[model samples]
Target: MTRILVTGGAGYIGSIATHMLLEAGYEVSVLDDLSTGHKDAIDTRARFVEGSILDSDALTAALSNCSAVMHFAGKSLVGESVEKPDLYMQVNVEGSTKLLDAMKVAGIKDIVFSSSAATYGQPGDAPISEQSPTKPTNPYGVTKLKVDELLASRAVTDGIAAVSLRYFNVAGALQTSDGWLAERHNPETHLIPNIFKATPSAPLQVFGTDWPTPDNTCIRDYVHVLDLIDGHISALSIMKPGTYQVLNLGSGSGYSVREVIDTASRVAGRVMPSVDVARRAGDPAVLVASIEKAKKVLNWSPKRDLNQIMQDVVSSGA
Candidate 1:
C-alpha cells in the first residue's frame, strides 16, 4: 500500500481527506499539532503523530514511510489574519517552509496543498480562473499564495510535484456518519454552520449587503467539504514529479448571502434569522470559481449543491 502523510489531518478538511484516503486503500499517517485541529476527529485506522509542520524531527518521523503529503494545516480565519498578520506569516509561510525542508530530507516528492480562494482577494469579475490575479486582501491568503509560489519554485529546483487546490467557502460535513470527521472550530465563522447555530434571539450576521451582487450582498461559491476532499484525492492520484498545478475547487455557480440565508432556512425547515451588517474590510463582493481547469486537469466536479451540503451537515450530527 502507498503510505501518505497528511499534515493537519486532525482538522476538519484534513480529517475528512484522511478518512477518504484510507477508504480508497492508501496507508495513512496524520501529523497535527492540535492547535486548531481536534484529536477526536482523527480516524483510528491510520497512524497518528501529534506534531506541527514547524517541528522538523516530528515531521520527519511522520513522513518516514509516506510517499506523499496533503497539507491542510494553518491559521485560516481572514478576520483573524488581518488582526494577527505576524502570526499568520510565521505559521503558514515559515512553517510551510519547514515542512518543505523536511520533505526534501524525507525524500517525499509529491504534495497536495490545501489553498484558499482568498488568494484571489476581490476579483473584478465573477468565476475566477487559475489565471486570476492573486491579490490577497488578508494575511491568510497571502500566506497561502506564498506557499503556492514556493511550491512552484521548489518543483523545478527540487523535483517536487505540487498541486494547490484553491477552495472557496467550504461548508457542510462528512457525507457518511463515520463519526471521524466534522467541523468543530471555536467561534465558528462559516456561513452554513453559523446559520444552523443561529436562533430567534442571536441571529447570524451577514457581512456586506451593499455589494455589486444581485441581492446587494457579497456572493460566493460554496463547495461541499466532501467534494473538496475528493479533489485532493484526485490530485494525489495523478501527481507527477517536477510539475506544478493550481486548480480552483468550487461550485461554478455563485450564490448571494441572502440566497444562502433563504436556502438554509428552507433546508433546516425553520426561519434562519440573520441581520445585514456593513461590508467587511478586504471582502470581495463576488468571488466564484471557474472549475473548468479542475474538470480538465483532475477530471473532477462538485457533486453537491448548497441544499445537499446543509443536509450533510445535519446528517453528521454536527
Candidate 2:
C-alpha cells in the first residue's frame, strides 16, 4: 500500500478523509497538534503523530517513507483572522512554506492542499469557477490564497504534482461500520451546528439582510463533508507529476441565510428563531461554485442536498 501523510488528520474534514483513505487501502499516518483538533476523532487503523506543522523535526520524522501529503493544517477562523492577521500569516503562510521545504528534502512530490472558497473574496458573480478573481478580503482567505500560490509555483519548478481543493461551506457527517465523524469546531462557527444549538423561542442572530441578494441576505454554497472527501480521494488517485489543478467543491446551488433557517425549521419540525442584524464587513452577497470543472476533473458530483445535510448533522448530534 502507498504510504500517505495527512496533516490535521484529527480534525473535522481531515479525520473523515483519513478514515476513507485507510478504507481505500493506503497506509495512512496522521500529523496533528490537537490545538484545535480532537484525538478521539482519529482512526485507530492509521498511525498518529502529535505535533504542529511548525515543528520541522516532527514533520520530517512523520514524512519519512511517505509517498504523498494531504495538507489541512492551518489556523482558519475569519473573524479571528481579522483580529490577528499576523497570526494567520505566521501559521498559514510561514508554516506552509516550512512544510513545502520539508517535502523538498523528503523528496515527496504528490500533494492535495486544502483551500477555501473564501479566497474569492466578495465575488462580482455567482457560481465562481477556477478562473475567478482571487482577491481575498480577510486574513484567513488571504493566507489560503498564499498557500495555493505557493503550491502552484512549487509544482512548476519542482516536478511536483499538487492540487488545491477550494471548498465551500462544508456540512454533515458520515456513518460507518466503526463510527461516525461529525463537525466539532470549538467555539462553533458553522451555520448548521449553531442553528441546532438555538432554542425554538430564542432568536438566532441573522447577520446582514441589506445585501443585494434576492432575499437581501448573504448566500453561500454548502456541500456534505463526505462529498468533499470523495473529491480528495479522486484527485489523490489520478493526479500526475509536474501538474497542478485547482478545483471547487460545492453543490451547484446556494442557500441564503433565510432559506437555510427555513429549511432547518422544516427539517427539525420546529420554528427556527431569527433576528436580522447589521451587515458584516466584507460579507459577500452570494458565493456559489461552478462545479463543472470538479465534475470533469474529479469525475465527481455532489449526491446530497441541503435537507439531507441538515438531517445527517442533526442525526449525528454534532
Candidate 3:
C-alpha cells in the first residue's frame, strides 16, 4: 500500500480525508497537535503521532518512508488571523517551510497542500478561476498565497511536485460512525454551524448587508467536506513531476448568507435566528469558484448540494 502522511489528520477535513485514504487501501498515518483537532476522530486502522509541524523532530519521524504528505494543519480563521497575524505566519508559513525541508531531506516528491479561497481576497468577478489575481486582503489569505508561491518555486528548482487545493467554505460531516467533525473553535465564526446551534428565539447575526450583491451579506461557494477530500486525493494521485498546480475546489454555485441561514433552519426543523450586523472589514460581496479546471483535470464533480450540506451537517448533530 502507498504510505501517506496526513498533517492534522485528526481535524475536521483532515480526519475525513484520512478515513477515505485508509478506505482506498493506503497506509495512512496522522500527525496532529490536538490544538483544534480531536483525538477521537482518528481511525484505529491508521497510525497516529501526536505532534505539530513546528517540531522538526516529530515531523521527520512521521514523514519517514512516507510516499507523500497531505498538509492540512494550520490556523485557518480569517478573523483570528487579523487579530493574531504572527500565529498565522508561525503555523501556515514557517511550519510549511519546515515540512518542505523535511520532505526534501526525505526525498518525498509528492505533496497535496490544503490552501483556501481566501487567497483570492475579493477578486474582480464571480466564479473565480485559477488565473484570478490573488491579492489576499487578510493575513490568513496572504500567508496561504505566500506558501503557494514557495511551493511552486520549490517545484521548479527541486523535483518536488505540489498541488495546492484552494477550498471555499467546507461544510458537512464525514460519512462515518464518529460524529461529524464539528466546528468547535474558541470563537466559532462559520455560518452553517453557528446557524444550526442558534435557538429560534435568538436572532442569527448577519454581517454586512450593505454590499453590492442582491443581499447585502457576503456570498460564498460551499463544498461538502467529502468532495473537498476527494479533490485532494485526486490531485495527489494524478500530479506529475516538475509541476505545481493551484486548483479551486467548491460547488460551482454561490449562496448568500441569508440563503444559508434559511436552508439551515429548514434542515434543523427549527426557526433560526437572524440579526443583521455591521459589515465586517475586508468582507467581499461574493466569493465563488470556477471548477472547470478541477472537472477537466480531476474528472470530479460535486455530488452534494446546499440542501444536502445542511441535512448532513444537522444530522451529524454538531
Candidate 4:
C-alpha cells in the first residue's frame, strides 16, 4: 500500500481524510503539533508525528516512507489572521515552502493542498472560476494564495505534481467508530456549529446586516466536509508531474447569513436567535465557487447540500 503523509491530520477535515484514506487501503502518517488540532482526533491506525510543519526534523520524519502528501496544516481563521498577519505568513506560506523542500529531498512529487476561496476576495454574485482574478482581502487568504503560487512555481522548476483545492466554507461532520469527527475549534467561528451553540444569553452574532446580497447579509458557499474530502481524493488521482492545477470546491449555489440562521432554526426545531452586527473588516460580501473545472477534470461534484450540512452537524452534536 502507498503511504501518504497527512499534515494536520488531527484537525476536523484532516482527521476525516485520514480515516477515509485508511478505509481506502492507504498507509497514512500524520504530522500535527496539536496547536489547533487534537491528539485524540489522530487515527490510531496511522503513524503519528507530533510536531509542527515548521520543524524540519518533524517534516523529515513525517515524510518517511510516504509516497505523497495531503497538505491541510495551516492557520485558517480569517479574523485571527487579520490580527496576526506575521504569524499567518510564517506558518502558512513559510511552512508550506518547508514542506515542499522536504518533499524534494524525499523524492515525493505529489501534493494536494487545502487552499481557500478567500483568494478571490469580493468576487461578486457570479460563481467564481479557477480563472477568476485573485484579490485576497485578508492575510489568511494571502498566505493560501502565496502557497498556491509556490506550488505552481515548483511544478514548473522542480517537476512537482500539485493540485490546490480552493475550498469555500467547509462544514458538517463525519461518523467514525470512536465517534463523530467534528469541528472543535477553541473559539468556534463557523456558522453551523455556532448556530447550535447559540443560547438565550449568548446568541450567535450575525456578522453583517447590510451587504448587497438578496438577504442583505454576507453570502457564502458552503460544502459539506465529506464532499470536500472527496475532492481531495479525486485530486490525488489526477496529479501530473511538472504540472499544477487549481480547482474550486463548493456548491454552485450560495446562502446568505440569514438563510443559514433560518435553516438552522428549522433543522433544530427551535428559533436560532441571532443579532445583526457591523460588518467585519476584510470580509467579502459574497463568495461562491464555479465547480465546472473540478467536475470536468476530477469528475467530482458535491453530493450534499446546505440542508444536509445543517442536519448532519445537528445530529453529530458538534
Candidate 5:
C-alpha cells in the first residue's frame, strides 16, 4: 500500500479523508495538533502524530516513509482571519512553506492541498474558474493564494507534483466504521451547521443581507465532504511530476442564505430561526466555483445537492 501523510487529519474534512484513504487500501499517517480538531475523530488504525504543521520536527516525524502528502492543516476562519491577519500568514503561509521545505528534504514529490474558493475573493457574477483573477480580499484567502503561487513556483523549480483543490463552501458528513465524521467547528461559522443550530433564544446571525445577490444575502456553492475527498483521491492518482494544477471543487451551483434557510425549514419540517446582521468583514458577496476544469481533469462531479447536504447534516445530528 502506498503511504500518504495527511496533515490536519483530525479535523472535519481531514479526518474524513484519512478514513477514506485507509479504506481505499492506502497506508495513512495523520498529523494534527488537536488545536481545532478532536482527538476521537482520528481512526485508530492509522498512525497519529499529535503536532502542528508549524513545527519542523513534527513535519519530519510525520513525513517518515510517506510517498506523498495531502495538506489540510491551516487556520481557516474568514472573520478570525480579518482580526488576526498575521496569524493567518504565519500558520497558512509560513507553515506551508515549512511543509514544502520538509517535503524537499524527505524526497516527497506529490501533494494534494485543501485549498479554498476564498482565493477568488469578489469576482463577477459568473462562476469562478481556475483562470479567474485571484484577488483575495481577506487575509485567509490571501494566504491561500500565496500558497498556490508557492506551489506553482516549486513545481517548476523542484519538479514537485502539486494539485491545489480550491473548494467552495463544503458541507455534509461521512459515516465510517468508527462513527460520523461531521463538522464540529467551535462557534460554527459555516452556514449549514449554523442553520441547524439556530434557535429562538440565540438566533443564527445572517451576515450581509444587503449584498448584490438576488436574495440580498451572501451566496456560496457547497459540496459534500464525500465528493470533495473523491476529487482529492482522483487528483492524487493523476499527479504529474513538474506540474502544478488548481481545480475548483464545488457543486457548480449556488444557494443564498435565505434559500438555504428555506430549504432547511422544509427539510426539518419547522422554521429555522435566524437574524440578519451586518456584513462580515472579509466575506465576498458571492463565491461559486466553475467545476468544469475539475470534471475534465479529475473526471469527477459532486453527487449531493443542497437538500441532501441539509438532510445529511440533520442525520448526523450536527
Candidate 6:
C-alpha cells in the first residue's frame, strides 16, 4: 500500500481525507497537535502522531517512508488572522516551509496542499478561476498565497511535485455517521454550522445585509466535504515530479447567507430564525469558484448541490 502522511488528519477536512485514503487502500499516518482537531474524528485505519507541523523532528518522522504528504495543518480563521497576523504567518507560512524542509530531508517530493479561495481575496467577478489575480484581503489569505509561492519555487528548485487545491467554503459532512467530523471551533465563524446549531430556537445572525449581492448578503461557493476530498485524492494520484498546479475546489454555484439558512431550515424540517446585522470587516460580497480547470485536469466535479450540503450537515447532527 502507498504510505501517505497527512498533517492535521484529525481535523475537519483532513480527517475526512484520511478516511478516504484509508478506504482506497493507503497506509495513512496523521500528524496533528489536536489543537483544533477532534480525536474522535480520526479514522481507525490511520496511525495518529500527536505533534505540531512546527516540529521538524516530528514532521521528519511522520514523512519517513511515506509516498506523499497532504498538508492541512494551519490557522484558518479570517477574523482571527486580522487580530493576530503574526500567528497566521508563523503557523501557515513558516510552518508550511518547515514541513517542506522535512520532506526534502525525507526525499518525499509529492505534496497536496490545502489552500483556500480567500487567496483570491475579493474577486471582481463571480465564478473566479485559478487564473484569477490573488489579492488576498486578510492575513489568513496572505499566508496561504505565500505558501503557494514557496511551493512553486521549491518544485522548480528541489524537484518537488506540488498541487495546491484552493478551496472555497467547505461545508457538509462525510456520508458515514460512524466517523462524523463536525465543525467545532472555539468561537466558530462559519455560517452553515452556526446557523444549523441555532435553528428553530435561537435566531441565526446574518452579517451585513447591504452587500451588492442579490439579498444584500455575502455569497459563498459551497463545496461538499466529500467532493473536496475527491479532488485532493485525484490531485495526489496525478502529481508528477517538478509539476505544480493550483485549482479551485467548489460547486461553481454561489449561495447567499439567507439561502443557506433557509435551505438548512428546510432540510431540518424546522423554520430557522435569523436577523440582519452590519457587515463585518474583510467580508467579501461574493465568492464563487470557476472549476473548469479542476474538471479538465482532474476530471472532477461536485456531485452534490447546496441542498445536499445542507442535508449532510443536518444529518451529521453536529
lDDT of 6 at 63: 86
Give candidate 1 regions above 4 Å deviation: 175-180
User: Whose lDDT is greatest here?
Assistant: 4
What TM-score does model 5 achieve against the real structure?
Answer: 0.96
Report the C-alpha lDDT of model 4 over 90-142, residue by residue, as the tens digit: 99999999999999999999999999988888775478998889999889999
Global local distance difference test of model 1: 0.88
* Residue range with the least summed lDDT across 10 consecutive positions in model 6: 175-184
What is the C-alpha local distance difference test score of each model? Answer: 0.88, 0.89, 0.88, 0.92, 0.91, 0.88
Better of 1 and 5 by TM-score: 1
Per-residue error at 302 for model 6, in Å? 0.6
- For every model shown, what is its TM-score relative to the native structure? 0.97, 0.96, 0.96, 0.97, 0.96, 0.96
**Which ranges in model 4 have alpha carbons more than 4 Å from their true place?**
none
What residue runs in model 5 are displaced by over 4 Å at the alpha carbon? 208-212
**Could you tell me how far off, in angstroms, the CA of residue 182 lies in candidate 1 after the best superposition?**
2.0
Task: Give per-residue CA lDDT, model 6, range 70-183, as digits (tens).
Answer: 999999988899999999999999999999998998889999999999899888877899888999998999999999999999999999999999999898888654846766
lDDT of 3 by residue, 60-178 (tens): 98997799999999998888898999999999999999999988998898999999898888898778999999999999999999999999999989878999999999998866665
lDDT of 5 by residue, 229-299 (tens): 99999999889999999999999998898999999999988999999899977667788889999999998
What is candidate 2's CA lDDT for residue 143? 97
Return the TM-score for candidate 2, rounded to 2 decimals: 0.96
Which pairs clash in the backbone of model 3? Answer: 204-273, 204-274, 204-275, 208-279
Worst 10 residues of 2 by lDDT: 196-205
RMSD of each: 1.3, 1.4, 1.4, 1.2, 1.4, 1.4
